[model samples]
Target: MGSQSARNIEVLNQNIAELNGDINVSFEFFPPTSEAMENTLWQSIDHLKKLKPKFVSVTYGANSGTRDRTHGVIKDIKERTGLIAAPHLTCIDASKDELKQIALDYWNSGIKHIVALRGDIPEGGDRPHMYAADLVELLKSQASFDVSVAAYPEVHPEAKTAQADLLALKAKMDAGADRAITQFFFDIESYLRFRDRCAAIGIDQEVVPGILPVSNYKTLVKFSKLCNVKVPNWMHKMYEGTDDDPTTRNLIGASIAMDMVKVLGEEGVKDFHFYTLNRSELSYAICHTLGIRP
Candidate 1:
């Protein structure tokens, strides 16, 4: 039994090494609000660009509040950096004409890729207006851009059921979405199960797993609650009392991410999307662990 356990660990480690060598990665960033944050964001961007990511995405704020800034940042990145800039577009608090104009603007600006989403309601709102209805509707309307829609490995927060969510994803693919980026998940099993379910339903688009390097456990827990992502009890326990130990927390976070990626690689996933949260260390360390060099 001991020998078998040791062999299993060896196999897992071997898979991790191989994945680190061959995996392709992308990153997501949000438009900065303040001058200080803007500086920090640029610094993070500069650092991660050294890894030569497949592309870098800038997220739009809820209700299109930061639409202008998002576009500006994306344009600047395309002009100044070597990374492919993909700005997120959402179907919330915007009319069809507005959404179309945004898509057209991106296309005209040489931004070919878009991460389309049904953004959450803004704060203090009783209910969202569903302006664009959902992502599939937006995808169907926007014919020029290569669209990537969101997927929930554990199911979307407002979804009726997991099967319904998968069907919705299939609909989005049918509506001309090129790919799907899943919400961040802790366990590899969640993603694997979701992928299998997608396969069973004949949804063939590439579903890139979203990797979030934990910078703050408390913050992550709060965000997860808002997004309806389950944070495993074991995960909380792992970081239970490490609040004061930034170094150890970051090390555990990187290890957890590397192990998750290794498991996903075993399941035949070759691409990953890191939700950088405007920071670089944890994401950088995880990439380094995967053999991505600066």
Candidate 2:
């Protein structure tokens, strides 16, 4: 009887630890391409805004017009929801002067945070900024904005070696990036090991884990290939029979993300960044399960 009581107490402790609300979360969204997508984006934002994410970011695509559209959405998020809006700035085809102008424009428009990235190079385009470190430097030169840069637990697809990838991340941090948001990864140890390596290298800035809830396995697999993120075999096995069931897939996705949060929280990872893809339900459910309340 005493042993049974002790076991119940231990279980209660574990539950409390999981629901302690020590976690902070931010979300990411892409700029809408059409008016219908635009409306959907806002609706998702409205649903998730009450959760009080630390900040929200809008991504920039390769096109020139997409930049302004990203800005408008970010501005609206900031003005309407009063949440900190971060605009992703990619230095791909633009010259240094042009990139600097864009940074200044964001600053002038009362937007203060930027996610500096060496974005995807357009088809047959040259590398103008060369690296994300360059973009980080350029953004810092323009203003004292809170800058975030990308990190990879799995080495970047273009990186020649693991050491080279870590060095690139160090360079961005050295260039005054305030935080590093890692690319979404399924292997939990990938993040834990990356954090250890960053600590070993003395990159002391905040390293936030990026969590992505799988909405569609097929789409996720395609994106994982493009982003160099690996989907583990066990995960594939879990989603094997959910191809035709969106509801079951979402439940599975939320369960996967919640497990990650519980493990990561126990490991002392205090913050998370969600790649929302402008969809709310899965992300919202993950946060809700994490004890992140409205």
Candidate 3:
């Protein structure tokens, strides 16, 4: 038993040593609606910034008020941190001219990166759609912005077929997207297969894996269903009976995220994007374990 324990420690040390200083990370935040939430968001930012992420992005919402809030958050992030702050722009309910003007405004404000997406289709509101590819084209035409688009490893929920989804991603890249950040995924093999397919289809751009460290299992399940992401049964089993124990749940969450990062790093994936739900403790712990330090 003593020899086995010593061997486990040695193996763990080797893994940590291999991962140290070999990975790059980025974070995503959403616009906060209330003062308390705003404080929490900034606090999270302050904590994560120590790791020196490649960039930070604020997610865009569907309404005009949410759009304005996104811009505000972007501007504040830039002003406060002097970091590369990207705003997510979805071509869902706006005119081409309006999007063009918004792109121009962002460029003039010293913002250089944009996460372009085709946002969710509004309920019972069928409008002429401008796809993410269209938005990427519009942004590139308006300014020399570094555009990032979304990718799905398990396929998009609204996609007609997996092939069609791959073609859609290819179209976004063909439209001048610099890279693609995948939807948060749990199955490493699924993401690996998706990368192989992207390479096969001539998507030469880097598809950064998006990692959402599970904090609340219930919330993750609800969102996963909407996004058509399959949460593996083992994950459900791990979180079972931990609903009343946030401390235990957080520990499990960090361990799971750490395991995923270790595997991805071993697979030669250098860049990772973390979906930080405006809280930092779990992500901070995971990054620390990955040897990302202040």
Per-model TM-score on C-alpha atoms: 0.92, 0.93, 0.95
Residue 258 local lDDT, model 3: 85
Q: For model 2, what is the error of residue 143's alpha carbon versus the real structure, in angstroms, after optimal superposition?
A: 1.2
Count the clashes in each prediction: 1, 0, 0
* Per-residue lDDT of model 3, residues 50-77, tens digit only: 9998999999778778999999999999
Residues 1-294, candidate 1: write the lDDT tens digits: 699988987897787787665788999999998999999899999999999998899998775558888999999999989579998877776777777787777887889888887677766766645432265566456656677788899988888998888887887887788789999999788889898999899988899999998868889999999788888989988998998998888888888898887778778888899999999888998888677897
RMSD of each: 2.3, 2.9, 2.1
- Candidate 3: list runs displaced more than 4 Å: 1-16
The TM-score that candidate 2 achieves is 0.93
For model 2, how does the per-residue alpha-carbon lDDT over 74-124 read when each residue is reduced to its tens digit?
889989999989998888768888888888888998899999888887777
Clashing pairs in 1: 20-290
Q: How much is the lDDT of residue 3 in candidate 3?
A: 95
Residue 82 displacement (Å), model 1: 2.8
Superposition error at 55 for model 3 (Å)? 0.3
Q: Name the candidate, 1 or 3, with the larger TM-score value.
A: 3
**In what order do the candidates fall by TM-score, top score first?**
3, 2, 1
Off by over 4 Å in 1: 122-143
> How high is the lDDT of residue 32 in model 1?
91
